[model samples]
Target: MSYRRLHYHLVWATYRRRPTITRDVERSIHRTLRNKARELKVFVYAIGNVEDHIHLAISILSTIAVAECIRHLKGASSYIVNREHAGIDFAWQTGYGAFTSGDRDKPMVVTYVRNQKRHHGAGTTLSDLERTPDDENEEREE
Candidate 1:
């Protein structure tokens, strides 16, 4: 058997960063994301979100690329949300932030995902969150 351990911290915003994720829809979104992650064979350690964006700590298999994993999770969730909540048009932004972490940092990353509400509520903005090296390249590309 092959052995691999990969963890990633992923974040993405709603289209135009709109506050479409309200209290009534948040639970459904989280549940949909969790179910989608499972279908993709990714282990989701933690997931949390505010109004406009979300954070996820996941362990992905080597068979799937990180981008593809995010694509599946984001695509499916948006589909489910839009279908179930007809009044709300849900769509993810064009790009996402995916940061890899070592096993040693798993707990820290998970904690960050779990307490996203508190962090943002306590005045922590998205810009204040940690960025990966890829963030610079992705930003420049856009």
Candidate 2:
């Protein structure tokens, strides 16, 4: 095979630390993301969200750029949310975190995404996993 397949495990959060994703809003976001991915020929292995963040395990299409894929997912989902909940004031952060996954890690990533709500209940955030030294320094200074 001359070409290789790629999949990304992505996580992103709401704008300004807002927890706008209630049960209904979270479901709407997931559904919108699924439909957008399908339209773009991307395969979604798993998708789930907590109150403030979302996780997605998606197979990246060779023909599509990652930035473009993220644009469609983020933009469309944000629009859908604002439309559904007119007064909810929903928006996503300007940046997202995407990690490349190997075949062996696919199952692990899928399980993580599927259990996002449960994980959130345990008070774990993706940022917690990537806490930087600068973050700690800032925290200590405060």
Candidate 3:
């Protein structure tokens, strides 16, 4: 196959640690993301946001560059939030973390997104979700 589907579990925090990602804001973000994803011809398997950060489980088509797609999502959504919610100022962090997932993991990833509220409430940090022992070992090796 000349092309491969890439599923990305992407996460990013708010700019300057504003912590404005409340439930209502999250709903808006989800809707906005869905619309944009549709326009970009990307499939959004799931999306969720906590008070400080957001997560997206998406399968992007091979034609799209991961970095460029993220930039558009982040930039547009940030502007939408700032415009729609006049009282609140929102901006995304300059960088994000993305992990590739296998096709078989899509269902489980969707379930995880649905439970993000409970997970975050139970003190499961982003690192807690995606960390591997190898990462620590690599850091130590470096």
Clashes in each model (backbone N, CA, C under 3 Å)? 0, 0, 0
Considering TM-score, which of the candidate structures 2 and 3 is the better prediction for this target? 2
lDDT of 2 by residue, 17-135 (tens): 46788988988888999999999999999997767667789998788988789889999999998899888878877666778888998998888889887777886645533222232
- For 1-142, candidate 1 gives per-residue lDDT tens digits of 8999989989887776679898867888899889988888999999988898889999999889998888888888888888888988778776888888899999988999999889888976446354433422332111
Candidate ranking (TM-score, best to worst): 1, 2, 3
Evaluation by lDDT, superior candidate among 1 and 3: 1
- lDDT string, candidate 3, 1-142, tens digits: 6888778888777765568887677777888888888988989988876787778899988878988888788877877787877788777767677888898987777778767788878976556454322321221100
Best candidate (score: TM-score): 1
- Top model by lDDT, which number? 1
Compared with the true structure, model 2 gives a TM-score of 0.85
Model 2: number of backbone collisions? 0
TM-score, predicted candidate 1 vs. hidden true structure: 0.86
Please identify model 3 stretches exceeding 4 Å from their true place: 124-142
Q: How do the predictions measure up, each by TM-score?
A: 0.86, 0.85, 0.83
Deviating ranges (above 4 Å) for candidate 2: 123-142
